[model samples]
Target: MNEKLMFRRWLDLASQNILTRYFEGEGEGSFAELPVRVRMISRFRWFMLAVFSFYGLAAYGAYQHSGVGFFLSSRQSLVLFGCMLLVVLYNTFYNFFPDKYIHNRRLMKVQAFFDLLFVTVLVHFTGGDVSWAWPLYLMVTFEAAILFDKRRSVIGFGFFASVLFGFLLLSEYIGVLHFIEVPFFEDHSHHTPLFSFLFWIWVCMLNGVLSIAATFLMNSLRHENREVRTSRESLSKFLESANDLIFSFTPEGDILYANSSWHNSLKYDLKESHQVKILQIIEDSARAKCMSNFKRVLEGDPFRVMEGRLVARDGSLIDIEGHLTLSTGPDNSVVLWAICRDITERKNAERQLFHLAHHDQLTGLPNRMFFVERLKQAQALAKRQEHKYAVIFIDLDRFKIINDTLGHAVGDSLLKETASRISAVVREIDTVGRLGGDEFIVLVSHLHDEEDARLVARKLLKAFTEPMKIDGNEIFMTLSL
Candidate 1:
């Protein structure tokens, strides 16, 4: 009994290990069932359904061929049917009420025991000496190997085979069954009791070979499946934990899937039904444009990029740049897998940098560097077109005196006000630049002549002559060109 218990425990462990390895290797979301109890119940239901259906068909066929009386006479058949029915009942109820048997180790062991009993009955019914039913023992051996450790599976096979052989010998000795006739070297004339005994020996040898082979094949398949599952799971983990907003959309512009970053960063949940349309999140005008672009991509065109504004859930707008590539499926259906980046901060920073690089930081006028580059380009264009351009350099008169008396901060404020005044006088085509402290330059392009430049400079000088308030002190300066 201790030995039997140990063997049973080993078998259980091995089967569980095989299942564990298979499930772990398959990949994430392989099993639809979440709770272990539910998964166990479902597995039990499936197993019982298959086993019972096979047994039911086999039993009905046997009764039809052999007659009900003959079937009833075979206690093996009765026992097998009864055990199969019990398995079906247990599994059905366990599926209905998973809490009862899902975690019951003792019940599982009993089920395994019944499985062994069923196999024994099958063996007896088929005539045990090298019959087709011997393969059924291999099936039982495989089940044991999957459920338990290698040692336990081996032990279980040996012990069960011994029991079967013992029953065969006893039944034959008591005349309950006849010993099968065996031939010698395929010659019926040479057949003898010795040949019969040898044939039985051969049956025993074949049973061992079949059991070992089945166990090996099942174990290898289980290991391979486990590896595949594990790899898939690792990949799923990476996708779920990734930082970038990973998402895919159908060619119809319906969102198919999105990772966690899409939900956390964009505050968009794809799992919801109302949010299925990708266009729903985009502004109406932009959505139409995007759809047109996506159509081009779906028509077997290569990768495309789109930049636009995305309105957030809170009604705030965010700038997004998406890099979209077409993923063609085996059936030639196109999918757009896009990685969208929030470029709001980057766009704002770029605009700020543009302002700083082109305009004077203090006075909001174009800086000398920007003025020089633009002037050179404009002058070349003007010369080609037989047009006129004017360049006027202005220096503030007695500006150093104001800086020395009223302080440089006051002088700087005055200069800034003076710049604003000059900017108002010039046309949009004219460019005003701050050369340095107390110095300014203006570029007038497409001008009639140098007279237009002089008139603009005179207006700027008169605008600055008005008494200017600098830090609550009045200061006056003349602009010299």
Candidate 2:
């Protein structure tokens, strides 16, 4: 149990080291969340499978040519089978073991050394460096470039492989290890000893060039990959912490992704809005117009400031102003990217300012400017319809006296009450405006005759008969038309 625990701790530490080396400071939601060691192991597993296939085919070809079972005969042949089994066992252990070493550089170095030794034995028994399996040495050098930190390490691994090959060739030339006569290279083996030795050494030097070149190329690719990951990390941090609502949607209006600000502004949790439709956030009355603009944007039009009311999770409408852009995703699918800013407070302030400019502050009634515009509109309608409309100007009697006696607070309350009473007496279609202090205008449009205006004036007069209660005091008021 202690041994198992120790192995687990070692694996965990190894994985953490690999992550720090490859994925540290990577952006949120990046592929960096996957363990680098696990990714390396996954790639290495495929390399092992390719090696297995190559060796299996070589053994089958040997058996077909020699008319002898490759694994059943000589010690070298048995060792070849043993190497194949080792590859299989290693892959299986990596898949099944409770504590597997992943991207463990030290462990890989040891395995690579053993592989070099095993290939050297195979090369010696199969008539030295002319063996077709010589290219497998380059594979180890490439793996070294990917797994190690420097180009020197890759070259060192390649030199180790070559040295083992050289020692095997030297042992065979000196007759220290008996060279098994293989049928395939029988013609090559009949060459003079001196020429054969020089040729084999030359072949080893040629393989060293190939190994070095492979390492150089692989290292360049690794450098490029690291740069791309760094750029991605930087971009991800910017998007994740941005205050604007940054999100993407599919062409069909389905929400594809949303950032932290989007969730915060919309008051929806990440999981809750996973499959939400983009149009669902827009106010019902504005959706048709918004969708039209969205379609236009997707059709290659540049974005304009699109103002819409978005319904939040709490069912409050938020005024949002932003633009949408069409961009292709990493997967080459067209997506509509959006960056919307919350302008609810700004919009509310604008409405309040507009109200202040056009309406009375105390009475909540249209001021002089708005009342004049309404009067013009009413006159235009009356002229178009060939009808008469009456505009009755009113001034409250004794209002200044009441204001002076009761203070400005009571005066403001009485003004509000007067506006409400005048509003109640007028028809919904008529305009009742507070023109100025104690001055009002009632525009009765589409009236049939002068008598219709007098009846509305009578109603306004009677509405003031009920005394207004202000500051716990009932106060009487009157207005003249």
Candidate 3:
């Protein structure tokens, strides 16, 4: 019993080795009910049955008529036909109930070995060196090459087929096995023994060489195909994971492809993005300028960074900086490719800095620096156009006394009210700015005469006479011009 168990273990290991030798990575999926090895075995079994059926009918018919197609005697031909039929029936049953037996690599290897062994037996009985079934060995070699993508497997199966055929010839020649009759072709049997043996050896070697050559060519093609597939997958992943908005568009402003960031920035979902036109998201005011830039880029001009506004889903505007390029589309026509980065925060910060430089943060009015700049521009205009402009410098009376009597909050409120009152009295072309403390300047430009400045001064004085309200307190204020 122990010897039997040991023999079984060794047999199972050998069977597994044979199966894996031909089908290394064909099908060993981790998340499936059936293994790929079993499926391949079933397919190989069906393929063998088809080949056998075609040859069996032809050989049996030839044997029954006059032994013209096959070299086997009538009894031997019948036996071969019966054996082939039995194998076909067995495979058909196994295919119907694959779960009945162990459908694993080990079992598949045993089935494949038996399949070759039977073919070898038929070859020996039919003709040995000159058998019509010799092409079956090439079929087996090609099957192994396709199933196993490795060079070693293809070369191994090639050499194994050659060795098996040589063994059949040697066994019969040395009397270990016996041939009942010569081949169906009578004239070939009269050849010298040495010449016949050499011819058979040559035929076996030639089959091995051809099998190896075919395997090498097929393996090269498969390798190239895999490399191309991997490169395409890598490029797709890069596009999906990019941070900037990357997209392709037609010359007619139709969007073709948009990546993850592109859809997300525009507040569009995957399904909605495909239907959106490229021009729809652009701000109405910037669309014409943006399209002009797009046309220039499409005309093969060098690309440059562009600034524009994009209207978001919530009806808010987002400032974006973009880079554009041109490429061939699916129809070989010119298409535009663009990468847009959200620069909304950066643009907001820049606007804030400009406002702070020229305006007072407390009263939201133009500051002293802006007043000086406006005065210089007025001086230049008066020098050039011979037009008169007046700069009115006003000071609030007793503002310090009011601030000391009340808290600073009331003073700030009073200053804010004073700024508003002064701004209200100015003309559209006039500039009003705070010069720190209670001093303010009015730049009245393009005035017709000195009387216009007096009218503006009268308006400014009348604006404070109504007793201004400051933080729920009615405060009387006066200013001197």
Give each model a TM-score: 0.58, 0.78, 0.55
lDDT of each: 0.68, 0.76, 0.76
> What TM-score does candidate 1 reach?
0.58
- Best-first order by lDDT: 3, 2, 1
Query: Residue by residue across 330-364, what tens digits does model 3's lDDT show?
Result: 44988888888888889999999989999987788
Question: On residues 1-481, what C-alpha lDDT tens digit does candidate 2 reach at each position?
Answer: 9999999999998988766444442232323222343345445655667876787688778787875544335666677668767766765655554133444656656666766665666666566655566666666665555555566777778777777766776777677877666555556545457765776677568667866786677666666777888888897888889888888889887787888888988899988777678888999988987898888997887767988888989999988889888889765999988888989999999999999999988888898999899999988889999999999999999999989998999999888888888899888998889878889988898899999999988998899888899998899898899
Root-mean-square deviation of each candidate, in angstroms? 11.5, 10.1, 13.6
lDDT tens per residue, model 1, 76-123: 557666866776776566557655444554454455566666665555
